[model samples]
Target: MKLLLTSAGIMNKSIHDTLVDMLDKPIGESSALCIPTAMYGHPWVGPGVQAWEFIKGDARNPMVNLGWKSVGVLELTALPSINKDRWVSLVQETDVLLVAGGDPLYLCYWMQQSGLADLLPSLRSVYVGMSAGSMVMAPHIGEYFVGWNPPNDSDETLNLVDFAMFPHVDHEMLPHNTMAHAEKWAADIQGPAYAIDDETAIKVIDGAVEVISEGNWKLFSS
Candidate 1:
C-alpha cells in the first residue's frame, strides 16, 4: 500500500512533487475522493460549512494545484444510507483517497461501520491522510482528547500502520497540541509514536517508512 500521511495535507512544493511522483500518471488524468467525515465529529463547532470550506481551501487545492482532474467530497457516513455500490465504484475509480482531519475516534467509527477499513488495504489508490486520517492507520490511537469522548479499549482502530501519529505538533493556533502535550501523550502510548507539524508527512510504501518534512517532527519510543 502507498500512503502519504500528513499533519495538514500537502504544505509545500516538494510535498506536492512527492505526491505527483508517486502518482506516476499525469495528475490531470486522475480523480480523487476527499472524505471529510472526520470533521462531522463536532458538527456544532462554528458552522459546519466553515470547516468544510477550510479543509477545501487548505487541503483540497493542493491536489488540484498538482492537477487532479476532479476532486469531490465524499462523506463516508452518508454511504450506508445511499447506494453504497456506487460509492464503492467511486473509490475503485479514484487515483487517490484523501482523508481529511477531525476526530480520529469519530472517523474510525464510520470507517468500521461503513466497511471502508476492510477495503482500504486492497485498494490500488494512494492514500493521503490528514491529521485524524493519519492516526487511524495506526495499530492504536490514544491520548487523543478532542471535543468528543476519549477512545476506550473497545475503540480499536484500523491498524493499517504500526506506529501512532500525533498531528499539529506545537502549532500555535491549536491550543491542545503543544510540545508538552505531545511529550505526555507519547509517554503514555504503549508503542512508538510520531509527533509532526503542518508541513510534515510520513510516507509509507510497501513497508518502508520515510519522513518528508519542511517543518519540525520527532519520533517517540517507549
Candidate 2:
C-alpha cells in the first residue's frame, strides 16, 4: 500500500505543488473521502461543501484551484448510519482514499464503528491521511489531544501500518494549545511515534518509510 500522510490540508501553493508532483496523477482521477464526523465545531461541513463544489464545478468552493476533474466527497457524520451504499461504492471505485482533517478520537471511533477501519487497509488503493486521518493510522489514538476529545477506552485501530503519526507538530497557525496538548499525549504513548510538522509528510510505500518533504520529524520508541 502507498500511504501519503500529511499534517494538514494543502494550506498553500508550495505544499499543493509538492503533492501534485509527488502523486503525479491528475486531480480528476483521484477521489477524496472526507470523514468529518470526528470534528467538533462543524469542521466537515465546510470542507464537504467545498469539495462538492470543486468536483462538481462551482466557483464558490475553496478547492477550485485544484481543478480536479472528478471528486466525490462523502460526509460521514456518524458511525453505522454514515457508511451508506454510496460511500461503500465510492470506496470500492476510487483510486485514492483521502482521509481529511478532523478530531482524532471521534474519527477513530467512527472508523471502527463503520467498519471502514478494517476494510481500508485491504483495498488496493493509495491512502492519503491528513491530520487526524494520519493520527488514527497509528496503533493508538491518544496523541491527538489537541482539537479533539480524549479517548475513554482502548480500542483497536486500523493497524495498516506499524508506526503512530502526529501531524502538524508545532502548528503555531492554529490555537496555541494544539501542540501542547499533543505533546502531553505523545509523552504517554509507547511505540514508534512520529511527530510531523505542517507542510510535511511521510510516504510509506510497501513498508518503506521515508520523509517526503521539508519539515521536522522525530521517532519515539519505548
Model 1 gets an lDDT of 0.79
Highest TM-score: give the candidate number: 1
Q: For model 1, what is the error of residue 123's alpha carbon versus the real structure, in angstroms, after optimal superposition?
A: 0.3
Alpha-carbon error at 168 in model 2, in Å? 2.0
Least accurate 10 contiguous residues by lDDT in model 1: 57-66
TM-score per prediction, in order, is 0.89, 0.73
TM-score of 2: 0.73
lDDT (Cα, tens digit) per residue for candidate 1, span 1-222: 699998887888767777887888777888888887887785553237746664465544254334578887777887778877778878877899888777787888889778788889988899998888898898777746444564553445778888888898878778888877888988978878899998889999987889999998889998
- Candidate 2 lDDT tens digits, 72-163: 55445454765366567677666666665566666777676677777776676667676777777777755345344436556345676777
